[model samples]
Target: MAMRFSENADRMDVRYVAGLARIALSDAEAARLQGQLDDILAFVGELKKLDVSGVEVTDVATEAQNAWRADVPIAGLEREATLANAPLARHGQFVVPKVIE
Candidate 1:
């Protein structure tokens, strides 16, 4: 099945991946990556069917949570330091380069 699918990787069904990712992979690159992806998927398919009769399921193998100090107000950067790299500023807001037409 893997070999057959890889050999016929030219079908447009595979190209939809590039469109969804906003990429323009060339024919060679797409074909190459398609084969790799198919192989990975096939391996995962095999893994999914494994029988783990005694294994435990957890959200994560090593569960952890965030630890941090309490949030509190403190002194902040001085105005000179805050505007050091800004091209323009009005009031206290740093102006940014125009990104819209």
Candidate 2:
């Protein structure tokens, strides 16, 4: 079933959305955002009215495939080379400050 964006606009609360997103919005900001949200819903509603029944469904817009090269195992830098530029290294590993108590 197709979802109706316009019908859900009335139920969309800007303050509620902001709270869920952990954002603090003033009364004026909420009002502004609410209007913008309504406009977006109206636009989506217009899009829902388009005739797309004849269009073929595709996962990607382009025909390109296997975009990435084969991942082959190769020798990495030696331990000494890898830790040469580190601020602190001991026992063939980086020594960073304690992050947790």
Candidate 3:
């Protein structure tokens, strides 16, 4: 039988999260997302119940570490060349409309 999350979902908390994320969600969307989030949490809870005493805890399966390339200074485009295509330029820099007062 499939687990029902409609009863388990916290509607208010889901709305709070949506608000914090600066997203606009309708009542229908909120209800749908609440169920989905509840379902994910329930799945994680179920996974926590599994016994893994003998299993090795690892963040990654491969032995290879993060490979990084040496940072070398390379000549880039000149200041005038970069500002040439700007819609507005001030003091040799691109000028954009102020968003925050």
Candidates' TM-scores? 0.45, 0.49, 0.50
Q: Tell me the tens digit of each residue's lDDT in model 1 across 1-101.
A: 01233433433345676776668889998888878876767666676678878788767656567657788989999998998888898788898777589
How many Å off is the CA of 9 in candidate 3?
12
* RMSD (Å) per prediction: 8.6, 8.6, 8.5
Better of 2 and 3 by lDDT: 2
Please report the TM-score between candidate 2 and the true structure: 0.49
Candidate 3 residues 53-80, lDDT tens each?
A: 9998999978999888889988999998
Candidate 1 lDDT at 44 equals 64
Using lDDT as the measure, what is the rank order of every candidate, best first?
2, 3, 1
**Candidate 3 lDDT score relative to the true structure:** 0.76
Backbone clashes under 3 angstroms, per model: 0, 0, 0
Give lDDT: candidate 1, residue 86. Answer: 88
Best-fitting candidate, scored by lDDT: 2
Runs of candidate 3 exceeding 4 Å displacement: 1-12, 73-101
The sequence of per-residue lDDT tens digits that candidate 2 reaches over residues 1-101 is: 22333454544677777776768988899899989987877777787788999998789988899889788989999988999999999998899989589
The superposed Cα distance between candidate 3 and the true structure at residue 55, in angstroms, equals: 3.1
Please list all clashing residue pairs in model 2, or write none if there are none. none
RMSD of 1: 8.6
